[model samples]
Target: MFQLSLATVSHGAVASIPLILVAPFALLLLLIATMPLTPPRVKHLWEHYYPHIAIGLGLVVAAYYLWRVEGGGTVIGHTAHEYFSFISLIGALYVVAGGIHIKVKGESTPVVNVAFLAVGAVLANFIGTTGASMVMIRPWIRLNKIRISAFHIVFFIFVVSNVGGALTPIGDPPLFLGYLRGVPFFWLLDHVIGQWIVTLVALLVAFYVFDRRSFARMPVRLRHESEAPDTWRFDGMMNVLFLGVIIAAVFLPDYWFLREIVMLGAAVASYRLTPKDVHLENHFSFGPIKEVAFLFIGIFATMMPALNYLEQHGHEFGFERAPAYYFASGGLSAVLDNAPTYVNFLKLAEVSASTGGGGESTPAAEHAAVHQLLADRPELVIAVSLGAVFFGAMTYIGNGPNFMVKSIAESAGVRVPSFFGYIGRYSLPILLPILAVCGWIFLH
Candidate 1:
């Protein structure tokens, strides 16, 4: 094994990594952030052709890195492993959760909306935010069809689609990335449950107030001449069984490779056994998961050298305080994909933490490796984890499911806000202030 070290690599090594190697990645990210928000025609062009652009740019970076750098092949191997696990879990959850259907007969009253959102929030843990959002959004939207408003979907993104995923690895991509980096599967239960509770409660309270005010002006009318169902019934319930097995797979025996195999098997079982009608009703398609995997391919490949650069000289980009990691990881997450953003910051924290000597101030004192910092300097990982997952609601592009929810709603005739309108009207006004309070209370 070729170990990575600053002393061995040297300051010249950092300089040797040309600025050009990172340009394609920078361009791809900038395009992702901007293309959809730009004029429609140009946006269409980018969307249609983004794969070609990313692939070409990725080949450029990969070819040069393999040619010029030592241990470059190892970087590719690690990125490949990370990408495989990350995408597999996401794909499995998407397929399996799609098979479980929520059927409700109710009006979307203030209380009903709250209960629905609350259930979705809790459910986000078992099935991922994307899965939960996919299964729940349609029924919720239908129940509220008579009096649906923009605030409904936005708040859905805030709580169920993003913030609620804080508690589990299966719940969100960023947390799953943390799990891949040796953070324990159940780590968030001890470290983040309180923060998750406070944030969810505050948002739910705000939602109740806002939703009730919306309710007052609107007439209470059910779309059909029927009373609400006494209890919700689920179709294709066997997927729920499969989901449990998949969750257990992550921590079962600590065999990393088996975990992926188990998850893939669960997905296959769900698809094979679940009723076809259930999938059709859930609008289950490979499109969203396929898009995620495709874009992340470029991200994983192009990010290797950047991560290596950070590993060799990460301490230079100082984030000494705990809050710095929280805010920076979160801020980038708002614009960039949160998964890579999470990994980038985690690597930064780990490398920076690695250089620290013992508190005893002795030359012979024990040094910490990046992996062990989870226990030694727990605050750092907690903040980074929270920020990446929670702040994903900051924009439609923050997480994969955000845009999917918006698209699903729009497809169903609900008018969603434009990308910039989403940030300016809702996220900036609603989410930012609450995040500030959270930062002050928890992060600082």
Candidate 2:
């Protein structure tokens, strides 16, 4: 069943996929990254036409695979299944979270802001970055609305949406995929807890510095007014139960689409049960999720050849050390969807281990190879896991939640950095250094 769901690219199909097939994926990414930065007329056209463009490009790849590749039907079927699961989980979390409105009175201080993000980081592990982001982003914006800046949104993506989820498979999609592949639930917590702490601390401290400066820049009267104690009220508390349903549904076996069925059912129930006023107060709309669904359809479809190419040739890249795996996986994760990137690197690590006299790399030997890699080369697994989750913050397209968060913030009238701005102004200059130190100190 797993093989059917995640069909490996056969050796014969490797040479058949022309390198030019990757062009659509690259073109799509270029448009996603640069379209927003374009002039208003162009950007407006993009807003209107992006769905068509995305779907059309995806069809190009889908057509190629169906016509040319062996077992292409199985591969496309796997991609479709993956897309359904991905959208179901994300859509369910979005709906359930949208039902719950967290109302905060008064403004936030840098200390309070730091604490809020810290708690958000922790909550990410339980309900997922998507769930936590949907639940907490509104309150976070309201808490600091008096002085909210792009940095606030960017840091939230950095800490809450990405790095914080490293502790458990429930925390990040890549880690969750690892769990599905037989990695123990607690393996990450046991191995990378220390590094997680250090990385979070570094990010929190950096956030504090930015937040403190933002706080201080406020007028004296507004600063004093912002210091008032914050009060909170949660409406639509019933959605919490539905949230638990969605999370629990994640553990259900994938056969017959049981997992997705449960998730979508819970989302429907939550949406129907929640009060209309609560949705109004939360300013919840389907626009954000709709955008994600459309763009990611293209991403999933277009990225198949890229992922397959990597799966085929990954071992050709001499990744002999943990740091090498860390940076390589991370660099790719910054662009590609991190989940498949994690899986491919894990396969590469398995191939590396087998070639180094660990075991055979045949299809029947694959399951044993995972266990062998875990027992003998756990560090490589750690690198792949950390790279996929952490570096997902590097771009809006890197993770599902990042774009949603940005869209939500923008809807709330908060200024968000453009895609390149996110990478240049924050991700590269700030987040990357901290992640680099972590890779150096730990994975190295």
Candidate 3:
């Protein structure tokens, strides 16, 4: 990574450059070229949603540039792989519990939907947001299909998809990554209580107001159908054990490889022991996890050089030199992948601290820098974790499992919002403000 940074700095932007930044253009061209061959339904679904495809491909370009300019060998790449694989296991647990449902009915009335949202919030910590999203989005939509509004889906993406996951390691990928790196499983609880409480309260309040509006506008037929049973019931309760196994895998990652093997066998055994209807009726497939597995493999493979370079050289950029850097790093991560960005900034701080401790940095200078950095740690962790988990709601590609949720929901006949459409509607109004507040508290 050092070598690329040096080259980029020395040679300027033209150094070893390709013509026309072909990566993104090429990706665009390829996607456009494939339109003719694409299935009609897929083409129709994606033509409007092309921005997501374009951006996913653009990430490849960004990775290449970072790799070419930064000189890290494979560290960043490996982290992406490990992180995704870990999240996937967590996602599987959500699947088993049938926890990933959407709040379709009573979205207009808080009384009916509050229970669903509450369950989703708690389940998010246990199963991960990706898990909760998959399980919930469908049911929520199915229940409320009679009353279709952009906000319905947008709200789902905001609260259930992002905010609900803030409290635990398993609730968000960034937090889970923190856990694997030695942040205690429950440490986040201590650090983020203020932010979580504030955000949670804000979410509940917003949900109540919005749901009341939605309910008032709901059709009478739909309203009657929604009232059949406000009381929730469970089926295939045995799936909770599968959910537990997934959590055990996350909390006990050292034994993950072994645990995965055991769990795979167990899931298969359980499938056989149970009635066929449970698996068939749930209509579960490996599609969500598999999409994440593949897309993230690319992200992992490509981001290596960039992450390594950031690790070594980021301090010189003068961002982490203040509390502002924490928010800056975390905010940028909302647009970029958060894992490498977190490592990059964290490493930069650690490196600066070490260098300052030595005579390499003057004592007076060292004193100022460390103190500035020291004060930032609380906010820094919050910035990174909050940005990674929440800003991800900004776009489908912001996080691994987002696209899967869109794809699955579409397959089930519920159209999802477009890339910019999603951000403009859902995140901009709801999540963005909350996250902006978080950024303000941390950065300012």
In model 1, which regions exceed 4 Å deviation?
1-15, 220-231, 252-256, 356-368
In the predicted model 2, the residue pairs found to clash are none
Cα shift from native, residue 46, model 2 (Å): 3.0
lDDT of each: 0.79, 0.83, 0.57
- The C-alpha TM-scores of every prediction are 0.90, 0.85, 0.71
Worst 10 residues of 1 by lDDT: 358-367
Better of 2 and 3 by TM-score: 2
> Compared to the true structure, candidate 2 yields what TM-score?
0.85
Candidate 3: deviation at residue 78, Å?
7.0
lDDT of candidate 2? 0.83
Residue by residue across 97-165, what tens digits does model 2's lDDT show? 889888999999999999999999998887788778888898999898888899999999999999988
Candidate 1 root-mean-square deviation in Å: 4.7
- Summarize candidate 1's per-residue lDDT along 1-444 as a digit string, tens digits: 233332212122322456557677778787777787788899889878877877777778778667766555545666677788888888999999899888876566677778878888888998989989998899888777767889889999999899999899889998887876677787888888888888888888888998888767664454332235535778988888888888888776535678889989999989999888998998888888877877878888887656655666678887777888988989998998888888778777876777642122111111234347776678888888888998999999888899889989999999888888888998998888888788778867
Query: What tens digits encode model 3's per-residue C-alpha lDDT throughout 129-175?
Result: 77677667667666566664556666666667776787887787767
Q: Please say which candidate is ahead in lDDT: 1 or 3.
A: 1
